[model samples]
Target: MSKLIIGRYIPGDGPVYRMDPRGKLLATFIFIAIVFLANNWQTYAIACGFCLLAVIATKLPLKTFLQGIRPLVWLILFTALLQLVFTTGGHVYWHWGIFSITSFGLVNSIFIFLRFLMVILISTVLTLTTMPLEIAAGMESLLKPLKYLHVPVEQIALVMAIALRFVPTLMDQTVKIMNAQRTRGVDFNEGGLIQRAKAFVPIIVPLFIESLNVALDLSIAMEARGYQDDKPRSRYRSLHWSHYDLYNLGFFVLLTVLLIIFREH
Candidate 1:
């Protein structure tokens, strides 16, 4: 969980960090869509190249980006393994009892791994660069139109922002609880899968209780501050679109068009 950087923000002066939060959010959405549009090596390569460029532009330490990917290593491997074993097409390479490997399977597995990694990396970049408040404000601004339809945009944004903000806090809490459990002779690492899962019960129970307490405290604090869903709130910092935002949006649009033109069906 320490390696999980999904909700943690790193302070940086890079272009990515300086870009408007709304633009970053929109670009991330478009990038996710473009990832699905990639169906072949060429398209994957192009997408990955762009991601690498973005990573470099962030000027963050290479290790930080790698740490973000480390937690998903197992999931990536499992996905690749599934693709290799189940996908059947192209030239047959080898076959065994209920298992076979083919050239297409090999290629497909590689692409799938790359696709997942690319998406994760892009998302990591967004969170690492943008603050939780900025993300919430951006989301609220983007979803503001939904208010005409009676959607609770502010409440939805608040929930999302709170959830994101608590991830690191919860991770820290889990670690502390695990340490406490270890002191009580609970062994989490020395058992089979089921036993290890069972050992986590102590941690999970307390974590859940602690999370509820935190939520209750937050509710009280908000009430003390007179926060209301129906109240008109003003921000000390408002989002301003700059030329850089326009350039970023334009680049993503061009990228989407190129990917659509080059992607294989």
Candidate 2:
């Protein structure tokens, strides 16, 4: 809930931004699979190269991309630590009580760290390049087949759209509350566990109240329009897959096939 992510989207006209969101989402999954397929340093190097090539195509600054990763640094470190301390097979480098470090553990730790970073890096690219509403619309359109099964596709899409819009709004409100508390002499960063828990009360209470008000207002507005969950709805913008989407999807399929083949080896 910081302005940190507010300006996270670096505006640029690039091939990555131009690609269909559905295509990028599918490609990201395939790319993550390739990263996991890597069993050695060589394959990991290839994965890194692929990720770098993707970033280059985005036309966004390297610093901006790296900034998006700052939040996940702790998660990556924790994953590496868990693998290093628990995984045991190869020659041991160190031992103490129930804890031991081995070559296999070290190798696995590195691979796991790389895997986590790669997944987050690719996903961050998706959010950075595409607007949240577009992603929701794309997902809804892609899942249109569910409509024939009596699923509330349009309602689900509306929920996704609202959630996306609320993310930034909620973030901004959190910041405001933090700043207000800070003005009244509150220190969130330098607090002990209990103090920190108490500190969040001020911020969370307001956020909950404000969120409830917004939800009520939205529900009322929807009811005013005779909105029904299962009713058919028309989209202001239609979704269509272009040649680029088809080509990219084919590339992802090929990549997945190659990854599976090489991973088995």
Instruction: Find the candidate with the highest lDDT and give its number.
Output: 1
lDDT of 2 by residue, 1-265 (tens): 4435422455678777777877887787778766767787766766676677677878888888777788778989998998998988989999988788999999999999988887877877787887777778878777879989999888888988888778878889999999999999999987689999999999999999999999999999988989877566667866567886776677666656655655637
Q: Which lDDT value does model 2 have at 123? A: 78
Candidate 1 lDDT over residue span 1-265, tens digit each? 4556876799999888889999999999999987899888788888998899889878999899888888889999999999998888888888887678999899999999999999898889899999988988898999899999999998898789788878879989999999999999999898799999999889989999999999999999988999988988887769999987887788888888878889876
Candidate 1, residue 254: lDDT: 81
Each candidate: how many clashes? 0, 0
Candidate 1 residue spans exceeding 4 A from truth: 162-220
> Least accurate stretch of 10 residues (summed lDDT) in model 2?
1-10
Among all candidates shown, the one with the greatest TM-score: 1
What would the TM-scores of all predictions be? Answer: 0.83, 0.81
